[model samples]
Target chain A: EDQVTQSPEALRLQEGESSSLNCSYTVSGLRGLFWYRQDPGKGPEFLFTLYSAGEEKEKERLKATLTKKESFLHITAPKPEDSATYLCAVQPPGGTSGSRLTFGEGTQLTVNP
Target chain B: AAGVIQSPRHLIKEKRETATLKCYPIPRHDTVYWYQQGPGQDPQFLISFYEKMQSDKGSIPDRFSAQQFSDYHSELNMSSLELGDSALYFCASSLPNQPQHFGDGTRLSIL
Candidate 1:
């Protein structure tokens, strides 16, 4: 079974503070790694998709990097609005279409202003 | 750009009752996926469809059934609802090998 594990279940930071969340995974053949941000009682919003090691992508205050065995979501100078549960999910290689995602427990980040 | 849209944002049901959740995929996207997230838990894959055909299955209960229509819309039919069925159900859509975009989700509550 494909598995994903995220470190630092909960994190607290002051406004403008920077930090990185980690997600480790084990899959038969990784097709993609995804990052999503979810607010309380809300569906996850898409963040980034890292397809290969040494790949990195960024969006505003967030940057995502992937390695062969893990991925990192680096929050740069975060603000209170950036606080949310960050989720990491992995997609395994599959046939035709619509591969399922295996998600980690997630890291709840709280940025205090 | 349009995002995945889910209907009946919230539903309340009693045990043994049935409920249906609907999803409209983003335009030009052909794959739809269903996921269930319990309180304080990450979303769990339930099922998926592509090109109006069932393409994958996961931890979905036997009482739950879902299908994608010709219009690329999908519905999840859940029967014999139990308290354990209460959760946030999310629908996502994407093109082949692309990142899936999620809907706001339907919050289901069983009493």
Candidate 2:
């Protein structure tokens, strides 16, 4: 079975503080890795998709990097609005269960202003 | 720029009752996926459809069934609803090999 595990289940940071969240995974064959941010009572918003090792994508204050076994979401200078649950999901090569995302437990990040 | 849309943002049902959740995918997207999230839990995949055809299955219960229509809209029919069925149900849409965009989700509560 495809599995994803995120580290540091909960994190608290001061405004403008920088940190990184880790997501480790094991899959039969990786098709894609996705990053999402979800607020309380809201659906996940798309962040990034990493398809291969050594690949990286960046948004305003977020940068996502991928490797063979894990992915990292680095926050450059977070604000209170940046606080949310970060989720990592993996997609396997197309099959009966492929195209369906298997998500990690997620990391709850809280940034204090 | 349109995102996926889910109807009946919130629902209330009783045990043994039946409920239907609807999803309208974004334009030009031919794939749709359903996921259920319990309190304090990550979203779990339920099912998916591509071009109006069943494409993938996950941990969905036997009482739940879903289908995509010719217009790319989808519905999830859940029967014999139980308290355990109460959760946030999300619908996502995407093109092949692209990132899936999610709807705000339908909050289902069973009493």
Candidate 3:
């Protein structure tokens, strides 16, 4: 079965605190890794796409890095508004180049002022 | 421009009834997909429509069916709805296998 396990299911941090979330997966064939931010009562918003090992993508205080077996979402000096569920998903074999994403359960981050 | 549009933002139905959810893909996209997300769970794929045909079907039961039109719009129909059918159904669109842009989703409550 294709599976994605995310670590530290939930995280709470003071404003400006930095942390990292992990996503490890088992897929039939790996094509790409993606990160999304979903606020309560809203659809997930795309954040980044990593196409290969050693590749990294960044936006604002969030940065995503990929490896052969895992990916990391690193938040630097996060603000309260950044508090939301961060989801990591992988596109496996069977679908086209960028097909349906197999998502993880997501990590909920609460940033406090 | 709209990324994706799904109608009936919220629906309440009784068990054994039928419900049809509609989706209009982005004008530039050619693929439409459906997914169900239950509370506290990740989204699960239900089905997908591409080129007026079914391209992918997930582990959902037989009660669920889908249709696509020439314009690339799609509909997901659930017959004999059950209590477990309550969920947020999201419609998304994209190029063949590209990253999908999603709609706000429909919240269904099967009583």
Instruction: After superposing candidate 3 on the true structure, give the runs of residues whose Cα lies further than 4 Å from its correct spot.
Output: A94-98
Candidate 1 residue runs with Cα over 4 Å from true position:
none
Candidate order (TM-score) = 1, 2, 3
TM-scores for candidates 1 onward, in order: 0.98, 0.98, 0.96
lDDT order of candidates, top first: 1, 2, 3
Candidate lDDT (C-alpha), each: 0.96, 0.95, 0.87
Distance (Å) between predicted and true CA of A58, model 1?
Answer: 1.5
B2-84: candidate 2 lDDT, tens digit per residue? 98999899999999999999999999999999999999999999999988888999999999999999899999999999999
**Model 3, span A30-64: residue lDDT tens:** 77788888887677787888889999998999999
Q: What is the Å distance of residue A8 in model 1 from its true position?
A: 0.7
Compare the candidates by lDDT and give the number of the best one.
1
lDDT per residue for candidate 2 within A12-83, as digits (tens), equals 999999999999999999999999999998889999999999999999999999999999999998999999
lDDT of 2 at B105: 97
Clashing pairs in 3: A98-B97
**What lDDT tens digits, residue by residue, belong to model 3 across residues B1-111?**
767889889999999999999999889688888889999888888887778777777876899888889888899889999999999998988887577788889999999
The order by descending DockQ is 1, 2, 3
Of the pair 1 and 3, which is ahead by TM-score?
A: 1
